[model samples]
Target: MIKIRNPEQILSHGDAASRKLVLEIADLTLARLDSYRRIKSIGRMEGSLLHIGTRSWDLLKKRNVYLFGAGKACNHMAMAVDEILGDYLTEGLAIVKVAEETDAFRKTKVFVGGHPLPNEEGYRASKMMIDLVQKSGPEDLFIVVISGGSSALMSCPIEGISLQDEIDATDVLLKSGAGIYEINAVRRHISAMNGGMLAKRIQDVGAELIGFGISDAVGSPATGNIGTPYAAYKSTPIGPDPTTLDDARATIINRDLGERLPRSIVDYLMNAGPEGETPKSFPHNTYFLLNTLPDSCIYAKQICDEIGIPALIVSSFLEGESRDAGTFFASMAREIQTYGNPIKPPCVLLSSGEVTTLISDNSVIRGHGGPGQEMAASFAIAAAKAPGACLLSVDTEGTDGTTKVAGGITDSSSFQSASNKGISLFRALREHSCFEALDAIGDVVFTGNTGTNLCDLNIVYVPGIDG
Candidate 1:
């Protein structure tokens, strides 16, 4: 069960039952994505046959087995694999967002790094990962694990590309309100391990690679959540590809990354060669998806079942501006409460997908918030229009944007709460400072290290007599 750190303050701000239900769903979603739980149910070792997901590995036949990855959830995934392989586990490395320098991690080298942004720590970890891959033998069986934040956590600057350039480019892309796919397209080019380059390197060494992923984006293969170092989507239409000059030009123009992005990044993308992604053929490679947004929504609905309330899975593939999605959800909840046309009242509307928030402006040096909080704060203002409706949007990974809180929830009472604290919702929204605004009203959600990542999970709930 997920425990909200300030339950009293949280429950005091909104409908207690509604906030409780929201937390229940968040807990269920994380539980489903727990790396240990996932590995236990799907992986097993019997003699030489090691089963994970739908594939079986002939361990006795293989020479050496290696595990490596980068992500927020990589720690737990590494822990689970270590437990499963036991004495059979040859060696492993994982770069995670948080640190716990314990004996368990020593058994499988773990490095802590920055998230949402890459730093020197990430550079060190990524460099080490490159060294590990290069040193491995041809007959090695590489089990690559990937989850949200892997893009940054596994950063390795290509030649001529400084870490600062990559950081500036990433910062702009993130703040420019681009979707995961578009942001990935830009970042993959500068990265040494993304865009199938890692897979190509593993192939060059004659090592066989396999992947286990927990998607944190809208699409599967093309979405960049799948370890490009290990697997490729069989489907050509949405399969992986390197970021092209045309891609960069379009993204920059659309999201205005040029004005804010680093000059080095712009030059690299503009002059990038035609040699983008390598061939998609993977004779010795296989990949498996451990969890997805749609799968988690089913688990959330199960909780709704126990509560005897109608639950609707509105959109699992939601995307675009965080504020747009947030305010739109508020309006939708308002509609459900007032008209009850599409979905009857006394219900929970669930949607799972990542959203983006364009920084109000990078010119000023002030605190900004993540998409989840932007949506929730926007709802707090919009909630005044819909008295009975509330919205809770959170990143399932237990961090929203760069804030300490997981996310935020708001209802009709949110306006009063804000007024009581003398906080201006309009100003917060304009400044893109939902983290601070939500903090003022005691509505920020908390569940440290949710042990999973499948994008953002949103709940639009309206309480009625039935609920």
Candidate 2:
């Protein structure tokens, strides 16, 4: 099945052969990243016993089994758990970035939540989840599926902090050019349902907790033998958090966001006692690590090998300014095509990481876009030097930046294509409106929740000069 919704539109023009190859690799890689299939493969129910990986839970022994999830890919993750648990599942609630018509659940209630920012609906769903945990006891079991964007998707600010204050604070931190970890340091501390707070509530109620998560942090290794219980799982809302209150304090000081963020958030983090700190350890929780940021690149490389195409996983630690990363990737394509330096022609280069765009002044933003769109737009301008080169940059979770589209794909002819339409790529990047510019030329890539969130996945194809 094709993950890219508009493949025909994307392959209509502009180095069709190269674009087709890159899209094929992307589609295959995304198919493998499906959480629904992954969870089902490792979990099965027999009679009254429920088996997940190497562990099994007897439904007869448990009073109630509840499923709670929050993230961009929570729809599929929650669905998998709901289907496997079936009649034994007491109730389920999940907060997702997008609720698709394709989503089918046996008993779970889905709540559409905001991403990149917190909203009232997410806060409501989070409160409901907290209530569900509070009502549970020692015999009850809580299963939480957490992925990236949960901090925003499962928004329940601390008592002293208003939802708007958390939202405003998140907006300020995102635009501050700080890394995701640095930003989460502040957001987690001010949140009631994030950074191990959910797990702490379950622990307080004397309930058993089973967590399934996808780690998007850079430097995380590929998930191996997911059937085995993970011992080092941390971060997210349902696991032990590695970030501390001091980390939160340091983020504000280092980013110089003391005055930029809401005063309530600043005051809460500044004055919060040690008891207010997030739980740093949850040794009793049985967790499974599904995928990491590096897994995307690793999977792409495998697809290339199966297809008999030479491929290189350039890096899984890609970060920094989005547009600049695009230019750098484009330069690499030219070097590979002209000099055959890294690998021969007709090769694929894959990378996965979180690239960010800094927007200190929101007034400069003329249109909606994300880091993936900016990178693709920047690649288009520089790719004009390298013929037959095609690049696809997407935020694997579907939406990129503030746009509905996942990201953008650009070929060597993309620059001239935009020029013919009287669109300037440079201006698009400058104004942070690459979505509009890319959409005009049918370069915008659309994938409505590809069932995984592994941050940004950049795929580039550099065909032979003669071919």
lDDT comparing candidate 2 with the true structure: 0.93
Cα RMSD, each candidate: 3.6, 0.8
Q: Which predicted model would earn the best lDDT?
A: 2
Model 2 lDDT per residue over 365-420, tens place: 99989999999999999999999999999999899989899999999999999999
Q: State every prediction's TM-score relative to the real structure.
A: 0.90, 0.99
- Candidate 1: worst 10 consecutive residues by lDDT? 221-230
Give the Cα-based TM-score of candidate 2 against the true structure: 0.99
Worst 10 residues of 2 by lDDT: 1-10
Per-residue lDDT over 228-265 for candidate 1, one digit per residue giving the tens place of the 0 to 100 score:
23354431111244455566668877876676888877
Report lDDT (CA) for all predictions. Answer: 0.73, 0.93
State in Å the error of residue 291, model 2: 0.9
Error of 2 at 247 (Å): 1.3
Pairs clashing within candidate 2: 370-401
Against the true structure, whose TM-score is highest?
2
